[model samples]
Target: MHKEQRDGRQEQLSDILGKLFTSRGWGRKNDRLRIESAWAEAAGPELLKDTQVLVIKRGVMEVAVRNAVLMSELAQFHKRKLLTKLRAAMPGVTLTDLKFRAAAW
Candidate 1:
């Protein structure tokens, strides 16, 4: 009811939320989502349709392409450019490299 009590409760709630987020690895999952969104933006809708981010572990992003030709093109030509764009888009996150593979879906 009092202002002091309300402030204390707010702080407690904030602390609890922080702990929950950390305990559940929400931060990493959020960063991964950001990276995926950035990749979609950088790759464009067409390219994005044929490619999907498989995982990001230890600063490396593994991407799955629909076909070998697309994978080769992405790895040989677009990898560096995509990385640069991703870094620019997500400065808070570090993406060291991208690995592309031909995947069924």
Candidate 2:
């Protein structure tokens, strides 16, 4: 293979990775823009500093929250908003639910 061919293939691979950076659902890289947008909107700046979203399996967001109180608060206060924002961000992202669990920090 020529250098140009190698470079072209590598560029293709990069594009694939860019797509995957959006979502790795079902162990397959698909529609990553949706996931990235969803994740970005789901958490507010204040909350995100303390929590981490580990994964989105199917339509559930596996979130690692720092404290039980905050988790409960978010459940009551932010769950709906987060899900709504997620939808706005991803459009078709599978994260219809947000599951907040105490994280091991």
Candidate 3:
């Protein structure tokens, strides 16, 4: 295949994927996945070891931390920064709040 033909096929595939994602409402899910993958990067290695994102619903993210102390620390000191990082990483999704909780896992 020629270079021009390959470029056109690539563009067509991109458009088809975009439409499929939009039609199935996967865009939000993709954004959530991006945010989830970004958590460790945003929180740093120390915080990442203790924290896990449980769910994101209605613009609120519920995060589980290893202990109450860590939870409190995140709630008090890191929530806003994490939120900002999430917002920057996933601009198409609205992440309005973070809820931190102590986790058994």
Global lDDT of each candidate: 0.85, 0.72, 0.82
Clashing pairs in 3: none
Compose the digit string of candidate 1's lDDT tens values, residues 17-48.
77789999997798778878988988999899
Order of quality (TM-score): 1, 3, 2
Off by over 4 Å in 1: 1-13, 24-29
Enumerate clash totals for all models, in the order shown.
Answer: 0, 3, 0
Best by TM-score: 1
Stretch of 10 with least lDDT, candidate 1: 1-10
Model 2 vs. true fold: TM:
0.63
Higher-lDDT candidate of 2 and 3: 3
Distance from true position, residue 97, model 3, in Å? Answer: 0.4
- Model 2 spans with C-alpha error above 4 angstroms: 1-37
**What tens-digit string does per-residue lDDT give for candidate 2 at 1-105?**
212354464345656665576465633434444465456656867887778777778788777889999999989998899888877777555656888899868
Q: Which of the two, 2 or 3, has more TM-score?
A: 3
